[model samples]
Target: MFNLVVEMNTQKIRKDFPVLEKGIIYMDSACVSLKPQQVVKAMNCYYNEFPACAGRSMHKLGEKVTEEVSKARKIIAKFFNAKPNEIVFTKNTTESINLVANSLGLKKGDKVITTDKEHNSNLLPWQNLAKRGIIHEIIKSNEDNTFNMDKFKEKIKGAKLVSMVHTSNLDGVTIPAEEIIKIAHEHGALVLLDAAQSVPHKEINVKKLDVDFLACSGHKMLGPSGTGILYGKYHLLEKLEPFLIGGDTVIDTTYTTAEFEKPPEKFEAGLQNYAGIIGLAEAARYLMKIGRKNISKHETELNKKITNELLKIDGIKIIGPEDPELRSGIISFNYKDADPHEIALLLDSSADIMVRSGAHCVHSWFNAHNLKGSARVSLYIYNTEEECDKLIEEINKIVEL
Candidate 1:
């Protein structure tokens, strides 16, 4: 087996996550990653030092909060190669996508295209828009659950917006986003990417992709929960109406009328999660330092090891593409006639291995395929070869029963 644990400095990385000391193997990063001590300390610094509202208070504490929050915004923007003013902070990826769905002002008969393999966050918003007379179209995937470019091309004829998941949490397949975005633009359609899974494991430059809008959760990237970002081009953000309007969203207001703040500020309403923002920025910095390319390589190596071993077991059915490279760091599979939840329980109880089960918020895909669910093992930078071995050993034992 390849020894990437040392090459990736995974032991040193594990030291930053205190939860790893508990002797548990965590392979569920697709849902929420374990926050490092650096992120926690950054958040603690915010609460303990400033503990004041940003852009609202005029006192020293407020000024400090505002400065720190501004810095956090710039850090996050740089992480995605976006302009500072283009970044809008929201509660999570769901809220970010919802903001676009509500603010984009899609009129009756306007067409929006998405893939059949989308997470519910990317799917439901357009479905709700359909209720208001928008035409929602779902392009079905290939037999192997890969994106069908031919189908997408056929559907993109008159689409108003094309919102798709960059990397699927269900099976870890990353669509060809850069090409897709280019084609959508040629068709005079705006593209919004649900990057909740991609941003954490891969390098994504919004400027490079030329995608109109992108949404991702900080919690999935070793940051704090309740922190996420919506990135849009400055001009587009200026044209779209605010999703949630109140307090910080406006510059000044009369009883009858209100003058709103610019792009980002207008979109970010109410008192924000100051501590979480600080933590999320620190998380971005940490990931940058480690290098997303190296992280992707490390996870792919681990996934290769796990996928090869799992395929050796009889009655094991792997999901998505057969190639581990295409699936990134996720291995989702089912044993014949086995309940995925029961398999998850067995792994947790017998080996202290934490994995995800069920449809992983892609219930529509499961229903379409007539499947119940599958156990998912998702890897991250901190995961090691030893842990992968342990997972394989435990899964082998479970299959025997």
Candidate 2:
């Protein structure tokens, strides 16, 4: 069922995002979303009312900051169906993934399995660690940009870690996470999912999904930049070696060995983006206000029409599923002779449509599929059917040009 939140409360919800009043049709949510007024106000409040280093100072302002951070943590944990202590704030998605690659206690002989459809943030950390003597294996996706489930099962025999993107940036396809986790856990392998492209568009229950680790960027989901989050199981985080070690991360440090603070605090080293974190909390709150279920339905409703309309254009080849229900609010396509960046320029200048261009950091997918480059039109809640119509019209003009 499609959600009617946007239709039912358009006036109230649209009021929250001041940029919506400026009359620009934004279609790049997969790249980065525009922030809502509520998030802006929340960030301003942090800087104006109570801005201090959380968990460090003892003053009232500092305590207030601490309480604010704690509140955000609890809110995020509840959103992800995780425990408060299990969540950690990171600078971005890359940092969150690196935390696992650096601290997850993988041995020299340990094998980590990844997908062909991974963003660089999810793929490179472990791949770069090959110099450290860890074995990295990439499970290729099918021709349709979906995972080869049987092949995925084939690679699980010797893998110690299964790190994958829950939703792909290149194709905007959502993988079946529940099955992925179930099969991997049976092999005693820990699973790490990059939810950067899925969190805002899908209904996620990490607890029910049985994933050991998940990472997402706040900015991509209409929150402030320089903010990302990592969700780990409570016990797993307790045992993890802190990836970033410094300042507030330690209980006691000396000339000798240093003893670290517990779980999340130990993992969070130094001063964080107080304003960004607060903004993210407000963004989550705004989503909660509208109900994520409704958001998902509305997005899916738009995706179906957009995907079908786009595929009908000549020389256009979509990289992911033909069915909109199988993907999120992303459409990756390429004209026969046009470079993706060139196409993006045309779309921006001629149609005023903003999009992403290139391999989208999924180099493996491009290589396997023989794509020179691709352009992506990523949508969000604020995007409308009228903009999608314009996109299709522009695509027709580009193809005929």
Model 1 misplaced stretches (Cα beyond 4 Å): 1-7
How good is model 2 by TM-score?
A: 0.96
Candidate 2 residue lDDT tens string, 1-401: 12334443545555667877766667778888989888988999999999788998999999999999999988888878888898899988889999999999888889999988888898889878877888999888877878889998999987889999998888888888899999999999999999999887777788999999999999988899999999999888888899889989988878998989998999888898988988898888777766777777777777788788877776778888788877777888888878999989888888678888988778777877778779988878777667778888888888888
Q: Taking the tens digit of each residue's C-alpha lDDT, what string does model 1 give over 308-380? A: 9999999999999978999999999999989999999999999999999999999999999999999999999
Q: Look at candidate 1 and give me any clashing residue pairs.
A: none
- Taking all chains together, each candidate's TM-score versus the true structure is 0.99, 0.96
Worst 10 residues of 1 by lDDT: 1-10
Please give the RMSD to the true structure for each candidate, in Å.
Answer: 1.2, 2.0
* TM-score of candidate 1 to 2 decimals: 0.99
